[model samples]
Structures are given as C-alpha cells and as structure tokens.
Target chain A: MRRARDPFFWGLFSGGGMLTALLLPALFLVTAITAPMGWFGMTGYEEWATLAGHPLTRAGLLLVAFLAFFHAAHRFRYTLYDGLQLYHLDALISIVTYGVAAVLTVLAAALLILVV
Target chain B: MKSQARIPTGRISDPGYPRASNPEYTRHHPRWYRRRMPIFWWLRKLAYTKFILRELTSQPVMYVTLFLLGKMWVLSRGPEAYETFIQWLSHPALLAFHALVLAGLLFHTVTWLNLTPKALVLRVAGRKIPGWAIVGAHYGAWLGLSGAIFWILAGR
Candidate 1:
C-alpha cells in the first residue's frame, strides 16, 4: 500500500494552529491595539529594539512566524480546493501555497537573524 | 455519457472456479452524479459563513506576520529605517488596516481556543477531564502568557 504524505503537512498545520491561537491575540492586543491607542504607555522604538535584540525573543518570534505562515498556507490551500472547488488545480495550489510559505519562512529567519 | 461493459464467464471445466456460481451476473449501475457545490454555499448558512470567515482570518494573520518581518528588516537597517517603518505604521490607512486585522486575529483566537478542547482529549489517571476543564486550562495558559508579556513590557 502506498502511504500518503499529507500527515506531515497536517502536523505542521495543527502545530501552527495551536501556537497561533495561543499567542497571536495577546500579541496583537499589546502591539497593535492598546499600544497604538496609547492605553498602556507608548513603547519606545529603542525599547522595542532592545526587546527584539534579545536572542530568546528573536527565537520565539521566528517560531511564531514560521508556524503561523505554514498554518496559513495549509488552511488557504484547503480553502481554495474546497471553498473554490479548484480540485483540478490541487497540485498547482499546493505548490504555490507551500512554496510561498517556504520562501516567507526563509525571509522571516533572515530578518530575525539580522534584528539587532 | 455512460459506457457499459460485459463480463465474460469462464467455463465450468475451468480449474479452481466455483462450479455452483452463476455463469454470469448482469448488473446495471447508473453513473454517479455529484451534486454541484454552490460557490456561495457558505453564505447560505450563518454557521458556514462564520466558519468560512474564521478560515479567512488566516489571511490577515499572514499579512500581519509579513508586516512584522518588514519591521524587523527595517530595524536591522538602523534607527532611521526603523523610525520610517513606525511612521508608516502610524499612517491613517495602515492603522485602519491594522484595526481590521486585529478584529480578524481576535476572531481567530476565540474560535481556535473554543475548539481546542475538542481537538485535545486529556485523561487524568483513569478519568477523562471535562471539556470545560480543558477549555479553562487553555484560557488560563493564554492569560498567564499575556500577563507575562505585560509584566515584561511594563513591570520594568
């Protein structure tokens, strides 16, 4: 019997989904919503830079960004296949979706590495 | 269009063949017709629409991640580049875009967290933990993480 390789992508999708759900909301609340609205004291650029400079922070950011991108890719691929009824384009869709995610993941890694 | 093919029956003299079996069985099976899925099917039901919207939320999540990456890129270029990126973030249009993305992210978070218990079945000792307990544990972890981030940012 031939084994399908879907489980690998599904595993990444599930892990990414878990992390995104766990982390994104609060991250957004502080960084996007309240901080922008000045509810909490405005975070200075230097302070943010300082935080971003930490190795642990960079590693955490990389993990969050990488998983989240893969999650989006997997979800969007299914969405296109099922929602748009583009099963005929399945192979192309998979290639484009995961391909873009891989590129973005590399870009994210580079950016995180360079953050100082 | 449908095509039909007939099966040839083997002679009873053939070895290893069941002699009691009928010479041939004629079966008429209609071609399967798949129901056409409407493009806007999700819009027809509130639940489906919500589900689709939740899936759609991932787009904004991806965009925000890209934006963060861009921010990091700018930060790497030095304070001037970083200042420009921050100023760009403050633009009215960008701020409005972030507001919509924020709503989408929050929706994604709530629905994702609500569904966590269903995905993770936890058994303590010989007994299964209640669904609400699992949900509460997730929310507790969320709160703890959020509190830690806040403390790190503001407690200094």
Candidate 2:
C-alpha cells in the first residue's frame, strides 16, 4: 500500500491557518494600512532599516512567509479540487499549488538573507 | 447507454466492471451517469459560497507575504530603494487594494477562530470543556496579540 502524505501537508495547512489568523490582521493593519496611510508615524530610513535588518525580526518574518505559503497552498488546492470540481486535474493542481508555495518560501528565505 | 449496464447481479462473476470492456454485461444494462458537479455549485448554496470565500482568504494572506518579501528585498538595496518601496506602498491605489486585503484577513481570522472549538475538542479531566470557553480563550489571545502588535508599531 502506498503511504499517503496527506497529514504532512495538513499540518502545514493548520499551522499556517492559525498563524495567519492571529497575526496577519494586526500586521497588515499596521504595515499595509495605517502606516502606508500615514496614520502610524513614519520613523523613516534608520529605524525601518534597523528593524528589518535585525536577525530576530528577519527570522520571524521568514517563518511567517514560509508557513503562510504552505497554508495558502493546501487550502487553495482543495478550493480548486472540490470547489471548482477540478478533481480530474488532481495531480496537476497539487503540483502547481504546492510547487508555487515551496518556490515562494525559498525566495523569501533568500530575500531575508539579504535583508542586511 | 445500455439498459442493464448499471444493474448488479449477486454472482461474483457479474460484479461491476467497465461497460466498454464488458460489452455483454452493458448490452442488457443502462449506463450509470456520473453527475458532473456544476462550476457554479457554490453559488447554489450560501454555505458553499461562504466556504469558498473562506478558502479564498488564503490568496490575500499569500499576497501580503509576497509583498513583505518584496519589502525585505527592497531594504537590502539600501535606503534609497527602501524609501521608494515604502513610497509605492503608500500609493493611493496600493493602499486601497491593501484595505480590501485587510478585510479579507479579518474575515479569515474571525472565521478560523470561531471554528477553533470544533477543530480542537478540549477535555478537562472527565468532562469536555464548553465551546464558548474555548472560543473566548481564542478571542482573548487574539486581542492580546493584536494589542501587543499595535503597541509595538504605533505606540509612543
């Protein structure tokens, strides 16, 4: 019998879901909404650079990006498969979804490494 | 579409098989139709529409992650590049898009947290914990975290 890898991806799905649920709302509000709208006082170059360049902050951001990618991949796979009834293209859907997630995660890591 | 193709016989020898391969069996049986799911199946039901929308919230989550990754990459290119990227983030068009993204994230958070009790069935000793307790705890933690983030980002 072939061993199904369902649980592994499901783990990523749930982990990503929870993290994104808890963090993304506030994070987006501050960074993308309030700050961008000039609601949050802009600290400008030195402060922003230091924050992004910090090892701990970079690590945290990378982790969030990695899990969020897989979380999106897993959920979107079923959204395509069942929601759209694209089950006939099951193998193709899984590959494209997870493949994109993995590639993006690697890209995030690379960018984080250069954040200095 | 043979009339007897879908009928089952008790004998093992007459078990279900492909109609094309067993032409003799299909000759006396009707083809069993595979009910194809409609592309707009979600539109037919409110429950399904909500499910799809919940699933789709991942897109904005992924988008925000990518945007941050881009921000990080820009930072690596020095203050000039970083300033330009921040300027782009403040663009009215981009800000408007992010506002929609924020709505999606909030929806995802509320839905996910509400569903947490069902996903996690907690038991204390012999008795199961109440659903509202589980839900309240989740909301409590969410508020704590969100408050901390706001303080760090916007507090004096």
Candidate 3:
C-alpha cells in the first residue's frame, strides 16, 4: 500500500541521523584526546562554529537537521497513536508534528546560513 | 434451581500462618485480595519500567532545550565561539554525560535507520526495497564513514 507520507524524506533523515550518530562519537573521542577533559567546550564550540561556517558542515548539518526533525516527528505521531490512543485524533497529531518539523527545517536552514 | 443449590461451607486454611487462631479468609470473592495481591504487585512494577523508558527516550522538551542552547550558542559566536563552548564538553564529568548521550543517540540512529524502508518510497525495477536492505545500507555507510574519519584523523 502507498504510504500516507513521503517515505524518501524519512529514509534520508534516518540516514543522516545514523551518520551523525557514528561520526559524532568519534569526533568526541578525538576531542577527548586533544581536549583538556574530554569535553568540547567553547573552543570545541568554536571548531563546530567553524564547521557551521564551512560549506561541507553547513550542507551536512542542514541535511541532518531537516531529516532528523521529520523522522522524530513521525515517530512521535506513532507514539501518540499507540500509547495515548490518539487514533481518533490522528489528523491533529499529524498536523502538530509535521508543523513542528517544518519549523525545525527552517530553523536548521537559518542556522546553516548564519552559524556556518 | 437456586433454592436447591448446594453450599459447601468449609473453613479456609492458612497453612503458612498456622499459629493464628483466626486465619485470614482464603475463600475467593470478587475482590479476592489474597489471590490477586502478587499479580497486581508485579504488574505495578512492570508499569514503572515502561514509564521510565518512555520518559528517557521521548523527552522532547529536554532534547529541544539542549538543542536550542546549541543553536543559540552557534548564532551568537559563530564557529569561534562554538569552539570555546565545545572545549568545556571535555571535562571528565562532562565526558560521562557525553558517553551517556552518545549511547542514547546511537540507539536513536539504528532504530531511525531501520524505519527508512517503511518511511520512504523507494522502488527498484517495480520492486520495493526490503527494510533489512535499507538498514544494512545505513550500517554499511556508517562503517565506511567511520573508517574514513579514523584514517584521516589518525593521519593514515
């Protein structure tokens, strides 16, 4: 059966989430070695800010943020349906979740432009 | 038929509490306290664990709060400011927190990736891609990216 929503969006979002999950930990590790206490603080933050400014990081974070936001929204919709029995209120749940996701996408784009 | 029904009135024995002259009634009733207490207790505990997991995984407000903090920090300082902010993340105490957060993020990624096939509409020659294949591709990419990063960072 055809899905009610765009599946490719989810796939891409999930893929980004997975990629970030893997990359972040290693980045954390390196940050640990070079960093004072294995923590990424203002200096590390600066590096990230640099990444934000960089073309690659900007592109990557934008993709990750857009997809991850929607993926989380969809998961949340299902959670509401199952746990809260919001089946009767499916339309409301979808509207709210997707709406939030849309806002996050815009925010992510803004972050890419201004931060990176 | 009601009037002729046999009523067996036998003293319910409390074998464990033999010392008591008046043992607690063992006869079943609608409320059946003695019979249901154990099962009810087990269910009550089970409900608590489920609640904890739900709270841990989907605490949207908490995640959003942190995410916003990150976003705001980025906006104000740009990369240089963020670098300073990230420097603080390296403290041993913070390392512990990062480890915990990392584990949670990993769980989120795998589960999210697994859902790709279901969430996305992808067809290959009129055939839908299997969910396992979708998940496998994610893992494969993860490994590839990880290896590449390690090679670059390790200066190989």
Instruction: Give all candidate RMSDs, comma-separated.
Output: 6.1, 6.2, 12.9
Q: Candidate 2, residues B1-156: lDDT per residue as tens digits? A: 687765755445554545444556544558779987778888888998998899899899998888777766776788888777778888889888888999999989999999998889988898999999999999999999999888876664
- What is the lDDT ranking, best to worst? 2, 1, 3
lDDT tens digits, residue span B24-114, model 3? 6455545635432332232357664444343234333225323533654454665565455556654678768666665655555555566
Residues B1-156 of candidate 1: C-alpha lDDT, one tens digit per residue: 222222324556544244324544335556679999889998999998997898888797897787666666666677787666666767889788888888888788788889888889988898999989988888898888878877776545
Q: Provide the global lDDT of candidate 1 against the true structure.
A: 0.77
Task: State the fnat of candidate 2 relative to the true structure.
Answer: 0.72
For model 2, the docking class works out as medium
Worst 10 residues of 1 chain B by lDDT: B1-10
Candidate 2 per-residue lDDT over residues A2-49, each given as its tens digit: 115798988888899998899989887877677656676654666666
User: What DockQ do the predictions score, one after another?
Assistant: 0.53, 0.67, 0.16
Clashing pairs in 2: B2-B29, B2-B30, B3-B29, B3-B30, B4-B28, B4-B29, B4-B30, B5-B29, B5-B30
The parts of candidate 3 lying over 4 Å away from their true place are A1-50, B1-84, B91-94, B111-138, B150-156
Task: Please write out the lDDT profile of model 1 over residues A1-116, one tens digit for every residue.
Answer: 11157988887888888888777766766766555454666456777777778899789889989899999999898888878989799899999999999998988887787544
- Between candidates 2 and 3, which one is better according to TM-score? 2
